[model samples]
Target: MIILKCQYLFNKILSKFFNIYTKLSFSQTGEDLIIQFIIGSLQLKKVTYLDVGTNHPFNMNNTFLMYLNGMNGVCVEPNPKLFNQIKRNRRRDKCLNVGVGINNEKTSTYYMMENSLLSTFSEEEANRMEKNGEAKILKSIPMELININDLIKFNFTTCPDVISLDAEGVDVEILNEFDFNTYRPKIFCIETISYSTNLTGVKSEEIINLMSKNGYKIFADTYVNTIFIEENLFN
Candidate 1:
């Protein structure tokens, strides 16, 4: 814990002093640094983000770096355990223990995978991964499942500046349901591939086309996740 604090402090000092020239990524593949670079170029002093299916508070989290920079947003996690961890680490953010879904259901079956990060609400995905020996289902529980637009409308006065979504198999569903016309998030970092253990996951053409149609261009593709920037903002 002490080491983490020291590292956090060291990282903050470097970022504040040297700007984005110095960065420490807590994302799966340095996505946060890329996000920070883009946000740095913006005319804004602070930005808001919504992390859907946000598994961790800091470790391997997409928005933790921004939190350390004194920015706050909302984090949605269906797993109670993970939600507790996020609430503890990110006291500044509004952390909710709920799942993001496309339907009007109040709750969904939350599949807790053996590898917690791969957990999902999709039975098909859970079964597929378990069959492939990638990860087994540890447990299943009913959790609150809110619609994509409802999430934003309830949480933010306007669209968040960034939305980091990784709802396992439901990433595209949530993204598709988002009200792009009403709310325009500046950036979106979404898990854009089917999960796999043997490196055969297929890329999500649906997500790519959806974002493109919404006027957001692909800024970077980290395989695990794809980062998109608003066309107007990118220009």
Candidate 2:
């Protein structure tokens, strides 16, 4: 009877431990969970990906998840400071220190907020903050711009299956720049933050419409990022 009681207690302990683990895993935000689910569905054992605006090479990234699953990709970051950090963490992936934009010529005066998270390519956004008494002037550096077509031709031997865009306030511009007829990525993860007192960018509905027009549908949405998949491919 003592042995059986001990076994029951052991089973209860194991059950409690599993429950805690499951709660922690599900506690991840919707975006992170969707990213994991998409990667799993893609069966990304050896596929390639492109991460635009890779800020920090943290473990929470879909790109990092790809790396963990034996996949490879490029991490493009425009911020010199952030790029260096990404390079340090993602030693195996190709890291490009250029901003992806519509034009190829270098542009200056891009404003970065004090917090860095509110950095943007839009001067209007910066000026608005200055008017509101919540901004500081930081020296802007000239950033090399590359379009999607150029990136694919220059960087990849073949086009990547997935492309994740996290450009602050410029997600739509970047999405529009891509010629979907020729280079339709199977999946996309884009950041769309609602307009707030401190933050300004494209809304979730706008991004959803743009993706829908391009034959993609919203797979999932979180506070920051939205996951889209090709309708025909996933339907």
- Using lDDT as the measure, which candidate wins? 1
Candidate 1: Cα lDDT at 147: 90
Candidate 1 CA-lDDT value: 0.88
lDDT of each: 0.88, 0.70
Question: Which pairs clash in the backbone of model 1?
Answer: none
Q: What lDDT tens digits, residue by residue, belong to model 2 across residues 1-235?
A: 2353355456556778765232111111445456557767766555788988776675345566555445778998877887898888677789998887765545545566674655667777666766776665475667777787788878888778778787767778788878888887777888777445644644667778888998998887765677888888775
> For model 1, how does the per-residue alpha-carbon lDDT over 123-219 read when each residue is reduced to its tens digit?
9999988997889899999888889899999999878999999989888777778888998889899889887777789999999999999899999
- Give TM-scores for every candidate, taking all chains together and pairing residue i with residue i: 0.94, 0.78
Clash pairs for candidate 2: none
CA displacement after TM-score superposition, residue 2 of candidate 1 (Å): 4.3
